[model samples]
Target: LLYALLHLSGFEDVSMEEVKNFRQWGSKTPGHPEFGHTAGVDATTGPLGQGISTATGFAQAERFLAAKYNREGFNIFDHYTYVICGDGDLMEGVSSEAASYAGLQKLDK
Candidate 1:
């Protein structure tokens, strides 16, 4: 999936060669993505529940910006934050904390 996303994004460092060399020494693509090292990744993420925690903050920021900027017919900051989690991710305490925070804040977006 990362290879496909890199392919679609056409990120400069993620060449076809880079895709083939993914996870190898010195390759731009690592086993886990490194944000800022890559152009397309929004946040540094891994297999754990970190993605949920990061995404909660990201979505809250988006919501705040949307509320602050968007006028009746002049929408500016509009996009849905998407997260896909596995059973392991959900089992993590950070994920539960993030979920509870989202619920408490009513972060519907």
Candidate 2:
């Protein structure tokens, strides 16, 4: 569903057939989404809180880059980081810690 959504939303790299073959051996889709391994997967998310935590890190990096390089009128680093997490993710301690840090940094995503 997530991959489908991404594809429908214009992420052309997302393959529906790969997602259909999810978890199968030798398939592009794995048991969990791997960032570089999968075409459109943004993060590895086998563990409950891993995705959110990784997204927080990505958001921090974006903020740092924007602060260091973005000009007043020419916004070079103007991307947003988004994360989708479930109840299990919210229950994890790692998620709590990551969320706290993101909140402190004022990460909108």
Candidate 3:
């Protein structure tokens, strides 16, 4: 599903073939989406909690950039970071910790 979304976002390497070949050795669509290995992936994450932690980091970076560069009527860093997770992910302590930090920091975007 995510590989298809990446393809829809216009990343050429995430084409249908790669999506179909997911989890196969030598395929770009590994079980864990790697930053450099996949053209559109932004981080190298392992388990569910790790993915949330990485996303929180990205969101933190985005917030920092927005504060530093954004101005009235000229927003330079207005993009957002997004993620999806299952019930199992929420059960992880790391994910909860990352979520708590993001919430406390008000990293809504």
What's the TM-score of each model vs. the native?
0.80, 0.84, 0.90
Q: Clashes per prediction?
A: 0, 0, 0
lDDT of 2 by residue, 1-109 (tens): 6676666777656567766877789877676777787566777788899888999999999889998999999899999888888899999999999999999989984
RMSD of each candidate relative to the true structure: 2.2, 1.8, 1.4
- Which structure among the candidates has the greatest TM-score? 3
Local accuracy of candidate 3 as per-residue lDDT tens digits, 3-97: 88999988999988999999999999998788899997888877868888888999999888888989999999988888867788889999999
Point out the worst 10-residue segment of candidate 2 by lDDT.
10-19
Ranking by lDDT: 3, 1, 2
| TM-score, candidate number 3 | 0.90
lDDT of 1 by residue, 16-39 (tens): 888888889988788677888766
Candidate with best lDDT: 3
Task: Indicate whether candidate 2 or candidate 3 has the larger lDDT.
Answer: 3
